[model samples]
Target chain A: MKTPALIVSGVLALLLAGCATRRVDESPVAAGQTTFATKEEVAAADEHDDWDTVAVVEVHDPIEPVNRGIFWFNHQLYTYVAKPFSKAYKSIFPKWVRHGIGNAYENIKYPIRVVNHTLQGRLDRTATETGRFLVNTTAGVGGVMKPADKIPALADVPKADTGQTFSKWGAPHGPYLVFPVLGPTTTRDLVGTAGDTALNPVAWVGLLFGGAAWTTAISAPSGAHGVPDQMDRYDMATKDALDPYISARSGYIQYREAASER
Target chain B: MKNIFFLLLGLCVGAMTSNASTEAAEANLRSTIDQVLVVTKKGKGGQSMANQLTPILVRHMCFESMTRRAVGPGWRQFTPEQKAEATKLFSKLIIRNYSKKFTPGELAEIEFLKPSSPGAGKVEIPTKTVYKGSRYNITYRLEDRGSWLITDILAEGISFVANYRAQFDVLVRKGGAVAVIASLKQSLERT
Candidate 1:
């Protein structure tokens, strides 16, 4: 019952994210360039004394209530709900199951990577696919892929080598927003959730709801084993964080950069 | 259709009944953990147990959610060049963080408690993970699937979302999402 509701609600939420409210005046990109020029230039600009010409740039966009709502929804679902569930699943499943779930997700995306690589005319993508397929099928399936062998090549594909589905219907990257629960996301990525749902095979796999839920329930302990460590690291990063919004924004940028490299 | 529904009902009922009797589940885990420990003691190399188990421990708790939250936004902002750089660096950083936690000579143990009644189509499973020999009560609230899939965790009183939020907030504050991400990627690559 909740599944259908979630799906339907997600669609509506995406629509909210999709609302085209352009705030042209507020955009930094509209006039062009960063408020803080590079140190060398700032020093140069100071020496020349173009301080009066310097202006803070900002991106202006409509405040989409719907998108905010959807963001909040995902936030609650993940922070308060899905995250805990993941821990539970870790507790019940054998190492094998974890590997299986990991492999399945990687495998399902293999074709997308293959297509992306083929389009790019790049050996890197092909190489990555080969590695992704092999490791995911063998080591990942076995739940014992050596750290040396765990490199997922598919994740290495260039963004330019995006899947056909993405190029054809990919949502445009909207203004970046810090979601309350889900963390950082742009409007486009938010909409991507809808697309992901439409494409998710879990609905057919019979693990999405009832069956998978119970299994996760049992596995929670294994998942929770290292939560303290993760928390500790997070604390280190944010304890003296001057401003959460800016920090989160910077972190997301760094994270995306890292994701692309992977 | 009626028969199928009946079968589904039967399965649901059986699951409910079985889950209601969770003493067996707790006992089963206790025995398994104990057996693993016993094997480790008798094993030729103390290293074997640590090597065999630490990966699972790290892999399971590497805190992918933190990375996900850290990466999900500004995904579109990155050029293919920036994106690639960011992704690889971030992954390395995450791995490094995990490596730091699962350090040598740090004693850690995980014990399954009992399952609570399911809520919001999910269930709460209690456990305690002793890290560096300090036991902290942890809870795994899981959503249902044919086979369970873990998506989140809570340790002590901190939820995964909160932990990630703290980290991400720093990023956002430092440079908006994009700047935060860029610096993180730079740091990850530098390491």
Candidate 2:
């Protein structure tokens, strides 16, 4: 019993160490501009600032060539395989049923959001989200319906994630990455995603059941379900672009920036 | 007693007028979204969608205000003409971006909810859009400027203006207004 407990503790410590290794240094900010409390505050400052000299805030992209190659490969995979699979999935499941499943998935993933919100010191969000989970789990019939959102006070509980938490903690987005089959992401978000996956209840249950196979089987579909919509948006965003790659990069960066802001 | 009664009546009328304006604003937004959806379903290409949506967007969206906020402090430096040019470019960029996001098959249904008053003269109208397998929450922030115009949009609590500003702030910091405008132009040309 003592030996098994020691091994388990050792494994947990190693896992945490792996996560710590993924965090890069904080990104540099411009002169006179403090790290903003909210994205809106940054915009508000922009509205009030006078014309001054400029300083570039560089996006660190050390392996652009490799990332671009992977981006192309992901695009092909999405267009050829993932999109078709998503289409079939859509056709098989009616809109309402699919929505229920999505809601259930979101409900199950509450721990990810709640933990991240708490880590970011958003107590109000943590409470409200916890309330939402409780209400949805029971009143919403195991999260198939989102009745809590109808409550005015609970309507706008923001979606918190590990990536956003890392940003709040001043972790730099180390480099742009186009993950194979995952499309556009950053080094920071890549790490955050891994952490979130590790924290997922479904993944843990699967690990308890049939180990890695069950975990992958359950998690893969959730990731795959959103691919078709993502691909469509990508196609639309880059339809008439001179360089689709640049457009995708700009869009992704802007999206992540806004998303990470409180 | 008569004077007091008239004052109360005036207050009542004011409340009614405010409620009426909010409803009108919500209706206008719904109609705009409906028109865009219809155009999207027609299988119109990007340019056509952009053309159709731009006028409606300009009419309803507070582009001047949004542009000012997006450009940040450097906005004071530009001439009125330059500001107008920047606003146009920004509007075009947004329209193009919006056009790209309009996939007909993905959106199964859209339902507009009652407007919430966030503050004086500002209302947030929430809409639930159901796609293939998920529901997205979108809130339009409308401010009354004679008529109600959208100042910002929040999708799942992420503001569109804020997102653009995050990217634009960096660009403006590195280069001046020219760089920012050039970047917008480049994005527009690409889209």
Candidate 3:
């Protein structure tokens, strides 16, 4: 009996030793303690199999504390204010009218697209965007209708923006950051947003028309026109996410990369 | 020539049958999801209701595949008992999330795009789902294994399986199977 027991103990010891040498898992393993608590863990988890093949852009988030705080702020702003306002606006207006308003806003932003396309050295895309703008402005009645959409060539021009232009210019996305209302953006992209804003006629509404009321009137509807779609994306990313911040950050990067490439 | 004609006829009939099978799979998924939403939307969604949902979800979702894939290469490291525990835990976690995820009547406004074949034995149903005035694009990916069953879901391009895998990969790499099981338990409890 002593000999058999000794053999069993020896075998258990060997198995325990093997387990110790192989995996050095220092996590506390406490229930309800740490569920995707850090982005470092996500970034550190590398390609182990085919499932990991889906590219999740890993961005350096040095100001994660600030970003998280801002992320929380943006989420609240969207949920409480933006969402209710949009719902009210939707109730007031039919979808087509809102869609037309949205299209008009998109049309107003064409200068940014065209200029960025030119900067990116895509003359063909620049031409297509210019053509789209002209067609939508004239026949579509100041972009309320997407007449250009009927033309297959003008329909699917990949949207170009100042951030994509910066990417094309070989600028790296430096330090991920989230703004209070603006949500997620990088330092380079923030600068790019400023550049794009400069190109936007909506920003000029105050200077050209010259009144806070006029700007607000234009901005309110413009924001309402597209805010729902963005909120939708935000909800999708964060709804069932393990870590909402990491999920949003990774998603933002992946989308930006895809847009730039597209 | 007669043999050739018969072979061609058989091929045509097989093609039609396959197409019908694919359509049925998509229809089945749509029905299953609608049923799930209906149950969730009910005033009193009790343990009994959840009990009923589990079998339907089990029938339609390939939980084992999702668990294996989400665990990544470290799945091989787990002992047989450990593997079984991990799979069971993951299924519970996923089902809990799935059952409770809808925002009041989100699926009521769902507009399912035509299901398309991504590859052999796989079909994808893309839908524009709405909740609280927000329109979300969610794509359900199903694999045919005797029956068409969901393997993964992509919400606005964020994959459900890959999302967990990122977190699990870290734990699996650092602590191994025990760590993953613990974290999964933690996630289930919190949700």
Candidate 4:
């Protein structure tokens, strides 16, 4: 095989390897057990189940310096390189044009979401995606595609919310991770990043640049712009000082709780 | 030689002109949003606030940037039509509810924190909100579309993305997706 072929083969082997071995840290909550309720609603339901109180203890909180290092790496890359292209895109593209591009990107991913959910054993996602696509395509401006899908019928309630999607396809909320600029993630989700990028048109487009710098240059500024908002959001969630990490952990857990309910 | 001179002159003049225009546009956009922000912070009416801020925000911010963080990665999933619809509905719903949730008086003391340009076209504005004797640090991302428009907002650490996820999750549970849409639409109408 040629050099490029060898590289491709290597990448394929790695992906295959990733699939074969399941890390305990990466095991997502069973999709069947995931819950689809908002924090408030879950609390309001008055059904104080044992799992509801399951804490998301910080298995590891690397010092602020480590967190800062990741943050800077992520932000610096976005600020200098990726942002300029996004600016260029904004300059050339009209609002409608950008909207169209964004839509195309989203619509292509439904199957992936479906597949991921199915793999995780999330039945709600199966139903949710069904309704999502049908209704989104119809009432939602010709399914130009929006995240939230709403149809007239609440066809399956208990099954939908109880736990379905997360169980089947959820990337195990592996050990706690604090990315440089990407912020917090886990080992499993980090790997899922590869899958996500594989399916993303932007990533494919960025790859044509022939190096990571091009991708970084195109993506960084856009990422930088989001930092404040992300930080602000983090602050808002944690200000109650009620263990936000845990809240997020539970949210993710309940997110998968649907499978158990099934 | 004469043509080359003219071309050179035109290039110089064009650069000067464009820069002037960009500067002016940025200033105008900045001032307009500042005024608009003040109006919103007032929180006087139920639905009027949404009506008032919509044009200003739309003009200052692009739909994609405003909702990216709020909506999460899933935002990329919206179709152009869905994007527009979601932008209209989600913006209205979120702003109205946020205005209703926090009083202008409570936020009176909060100033817009800076470092607006961290890099690229991204900007962050620190907004503070006080509730039940506690001060909260809220921030919003302003993506540059040649000017600033809020892309996403964070209340403390909780972003609209997390909140919306949680909200939709609950709504999905309560009545499935249909209920979530109905609830969102109802809220949009009310606001």
lDDT of 1 by residue, B5-70 (tens): 999999999787657544443443355345445544454343454445544433333233334434
lDDT tens digits, residues A119-173, model 3?
A: 7779999999999999999999999898897798986577889877766655656
Candidate 3: segments with Cα more than 4 A from true spot: A1-49, A209-217, B1-62, B73-82, B85-157, B169-191
User: How high is the CA lDDT of each candidate model?
Assistant: 0.45, 0.69, 0.72, 0.46
Question: What local lDDT does model 3 show for residue A95?
Answer: 74
For residue A126, model 4's alpha carbon misses the true position, in angstroms, by 52
Question: What are the TM values for chain B, all candidates?
Answer: 0.50, 0.85, 0.84, 0.59
Error of 3 at B88 (Å): 4.6
List model 4 lDDT by residue over A1-262, tens digit each. Answer: 2454345435534433121111112333333233332344333433222112212122222343564466457556656654565566667766454554444444445555565555445567667766765665555564454534234352222222111222123223334456754556544445556666665444655778677777677555445444433443443333221223434443333333322333
- Residue A100: error of model 2 in Å? 2.2
Give candidate 3's error at residue A163 in angstroms. 1.4
Q: Residue-wise lDDT of candidate 3 within B1-191, one digit each (tens)?
A: 99999999999997777687679778888888877778766624434555667888998898988987777667778999998999999998777666555544334567787777756777788887765444466788888888889888876656677666656766887799999888777766663
TM-score of 4: 0.34
Question: Which pairs of residues collide in candidate 2?
Answer: A46-B72, A46-B73, A49-B73, A55-B173, A55-B174, A241-B190
lDDT accuracy of residue A56 in candidate 2 = 18
Better of 1 and 2 by TM-score: 2
Deviating ranges (above 4 Å) for candidate 1: A1-28, A31-100, A138-172, A178-183, A190-240, A257-262, B1-191
Candidate 4 lDDT for residue B13: 95
Fnat per candidate:
0.02, 0.11, 0.16, 0.03
What's the alpha carbon RMSD for model 4? 24.2
Better of 3 and 4 by lDDT: 3
A best-first ranking of the candidates according to their DockQ comes to 3, 2, 4, 1
